[model samples]
Target: MKLVLEGIGHAFLGRAVFEKLDFSLAPGEVVALLGPSGCGKTTLLQIAAGLIDPLRGRIRRSYRRHAVVFQESRLLPWVTTRDNISYGLRVTGGKSTSHRQIAERRAREVGLHPNDLDKYPVELSGGMRQRAAVARALAVDPDVIFFDEPFTAVDVGLKRVLQDLVIAAAAREHFSALFVTHDLSEAVRVADRLVVLSEGGTGFVTNRRIDGRPGDRSDRAIFDMMEAWSRDPAFSELFDGERKGLP
Candidate 1:
């Protein structure tokens, strides 16, 4: 399946975060939407998902079988980890001993502990919650997965596991995803192609294809783009903002 975006633009409160944007994803391709905070990365994702409409352009894609991992986990506070994943499968009418078994199996696959399955969100660490969120997204078996900085709060060790899990999932189900993140290293780790938002409130793509698996974060190609973009005024200003941190 091909996910297409043409002339896509968005704004909020009369302020434009992005304008005249165009991008797309093919089946099993993982693309990153990289931008500074408040630059409409998330807003653009909403436009892509049809959760919100763009202010000035059209979003064309086949929906009806898509899932999203928001910046926030948005898990049910009252539900256990196991139940959370199971419930999502239920929402998608995906039910079976096989589905629950697969969900639990995937929970383990994502590094969630067996003991943690029955625990509530309140008991889990920030990274754990994010893992549960990923698990829920997995339960849906979506053709398209929209990830909105899904691993922001995680630690490096945990982050690598989460990142690998996503790549693994994409490979397993052959699902295409639009992953939004500020970390260039992370984008390089998982993205088949990377799209950068410009200071002029526009964006364009960088790569047309990545290796079979994600490239190593330390790969020479990855460093070149990061080094060049580090001095980018728009990116620099974004770094100067409160969200400043190394990628």
Candidate 2:
């Protein structure tokens, strides 16, 4: 399955955010949208998810189902973790018993204890809540998942763990994803390809294919490549003469 955005453009508060933008995501392929702040990364994700229509664009989706994990966990406060996880499944007409089982299994896969599934979101730690959100998204077996800087609120250790979890989940589930982030290393660690937006957000600056699987990249290797890319003209030109450095 694939999602394609053609000639996309959007605006907010009477100001243009992006224009004439184009991008795509192939089946089982993880792509990271890396760009400066306010360059409309999240806007693109929203457009791709069909949450909002672009001012001018055509979006095409081959997948039957998709999901999004935002920066916040967005768990329903009144529901138990398991219930929250199964909400989508139920909405999509899953059988109660089967959805519960899937929710429990997904919770465990995302590093949440099975016993914790009955607790409310307020009872869990931030990382655990994020895990529950991930579990919720995974329970529906979506063909694609859109992640909008989902790990930004977590600690470094937890961030690394969650990153690994996302990569593993994508590999195992065979779902494509669009990970939007300003952090270059995080993008490098989690994505199979990297696409940078032009400074004006009018078009793509470059599209780079990542060399290896996330599991195959060591810390030193990631650092070296990130550093090298920071120096690459193709990477640097994305800034369009701005003194701001790649994060």
Candidate 3:
């Protein structure tokens, strides 16, 4: 396993978010963490990414390095797209010339135009900013990437485009990922396996493998799989009214 969480549990103030959660990510695998609002999906991702320490748990990360792509672009407004993409490299002590070279390469890989590299976040469209954010995460050459509902803000067409970029990048780079999202279709599209959290953040609902590889599934097949899951009793809570409100 690239990462493992054993008997994990956490709380805020006096309230518990989750208890005794066990999760793992294998090398080059993408696992979608799906749950309803306020079920602590983001909280679990943060713990897995080492952004926060769980109150009671042991986390073992065997990878060399990791990065995160947030729901918002979270770009530095003061910096140009090029600089934003290269920021991680610079922080890790890369030289100026090499940083520029690598940043441009990653930018192009994420479909950002050469001209757009010089523009600040405010000048680019929402989808373009997200592209830059993804480019930034990829620039670090991480062995693991944590995605926190990264595509929820974009329109449907652009969302698919960005999701494809993620699928292609994961296939080519062979990086493991823990993707947190409420959208079942997006999870079905990007992950090799699915793990669901129960409402109220008590524990897991289910953990199961998808039928096919991430990029190999056809649109019709994806729709059919989702339809089947929707009718499944295990997935009933996902579509219930309880999934709404809070978080």
- Candidate 3's C-alpha runs over 4 A off are 241-247
List, residue by residue over 1-247, the lDDT tens digit for candidate 1: 3677788777667777777887777777888887666667887788888889777776667645788998778889998888887776775564567666866987887789989998999999998888888888877778899999998877788888889889788877888899999787788789887776654475653334544467344567767866776676635654564356445
Per lDDT, the best of the predicted structures is 3
Worst 10 residues of 3 by lDDT: 238-247
Which structure is stronger by lDDT: 1 or 3? 3
Ranking of models by lDDT = 3, 2, 1
lDDT of 2 by residue, 1-247 (tens): 4999889999998788888887889999999988777778888899999999999989999989999999999999999999999999877785799988999899999999988999999999999999998998898899999999999899999999999999999989999999998778999999999998766756777899988897789899899988899888767754443446534
Better of 2 and 3 by TM-score: 3
Report how far residue 92 has shifted in candidate 2, in Å. 2.2
Off by over 4 Å in 2: 237-247
Name the candidate that leads on TM-score: 3
Candidate 3's residue-wise lDDT over 160-245, tens digit each?
99999999999999999999988899999999999999977669889999989999999999999999999887777777734455
Backbone steric clashes in candidate 3, count = 0
Local distance difference test scores for all models: 0.77, 0.88, 0.93
